[model samples]
Target: MIPLQRPPLPEELVERMSARGERLPQYRGGARELWRDSRTIRRELSAHLVAMAAGLSRCMYCGDSEGTSIDHFQPIAMAPQRAFDWLNHLWACAYCNSNQKRDLYPMDRDGLALLIDPTADEPADHLDLVLATGAYRPRTAKGSETIRIFGLDRPVLERGRAQAYVRCRSMLRDLARLAEHAERAEAGAVAHALTVQPFADVLYEMLRLRTAPRAALVFGAETVAGLNMLKDPRALRGPLHN
Candidate 1:
């Protein structure tokens, strides 16, 4: 997962939600019932789609699967006050939203959340990727908790991530060959392969390797960022690695 900027909600949707928030006390179970309303679902759908687009169409929690639903960073049952708050919403896949996270919200002694909210914090601060296994290991308490809650170490996700890493490594190897021959056209094709989504975390790691001994020697010591992805290979890493 990576830190993401919250997208803007439509002005009218914001106003409508604000009005609904104000009327929560009038509802049967306050914000609990509000979360079940069709109007609320409509507005949330809009926001979820916007967040998905902003997040490269990936789940905000795992950063792997397509974001298929709106998730409350603080579950509605636990934090009614934030039920309609834009900042409390996130784009998530079914696995993260329904199966793993559910209504579980663990906190610290001081009442701070242990789960990493990608919108509020950089996931790199908390988590580390095991490149060989394609599994995330926690660098901090929040990272560990987020991984546990979201099942970040699940076998399916691990396999998917491993495949992504293989793709990224394959691209780097091709770029290395292309560099030897100065094959600009083939290099450009290899670069395009790196940008294809689903597991950008893998590509990101491959890019970072430009500064590392082996990859740097393969690409060149003086790595150009954007241009290298197109003309060579450099930069990429793993929390989404820092």
Candidate 2:
């Protein structure tokens, strides 16, 4: 649901992969490693863990702090050929990655994949944001399996999301009050006040707990820049209802 940057493999790491016959065919001649070199696996996976953290800045499974490993949605041990596949990896909180989702993959009635790839799209689309409980429920069978397979409804994740949703709502109300009170000429002042206002830091810190508000998370210094990019100046100044 968030913009993520998966950095390219380092040259040194690539060289090491090439040193051994690691590059192999996958997913119909996918330009990937054929066999995983032990050392390369350690180095690449470690860095990937960092990049994954850097990507979402939190655990993909539960939106917690950086987890211990890069999750192979299709377990690397089982799908060793995909050990180096880019799209195959995901950031996993330690517990959910290992204890809960160990080697388990889900498929729908027709046996198609039924899991949410955080790297692909927002989880909110197929799932509803349950404000009362902060758990994701599939409006359909596929969604249910995704919720189960990815542990989207786990108590910890639900609580974190609930807290985040509350914070986001609180921030919106706070901004709305200020905007309503400020006169049109004081738009500049209102913007400044927004920075020092409560939860401003939380809003701007792009990479944070996933339980953090996904959209409002970008209310950073960059907001000023984004304001300029808006076609209508008035559009830049609106209450945070959304």
Q: Give a tens-digit lDDT track for model 2, residues 131-222.
A: 54666667766567767876777787677666755564444444444445554435444444433333221333322322344434534333
For residues 1-242, what per-residue lDDT tens digits would candidate 1 score against the true structure?
76666767778888888887888878886787777784655556656555444335788777788777778889988988888888888888888899999999999999999999877897778988766678998999988999999999889888988887766666666765675577766665655555546676655555545556575554443332432544333422211222
Instruction: Give TM per candidate.
Output: 0.78, 0.59
lDDT of each: 0.70, 0.53
lDDT of 2: 0.53
Error of 1 at 146 (Å): 0.6
For TM-score, the strongest prediction is 1
- The local lDDT score (0 to 100) that residue 35 gets in candidate 1 is 75
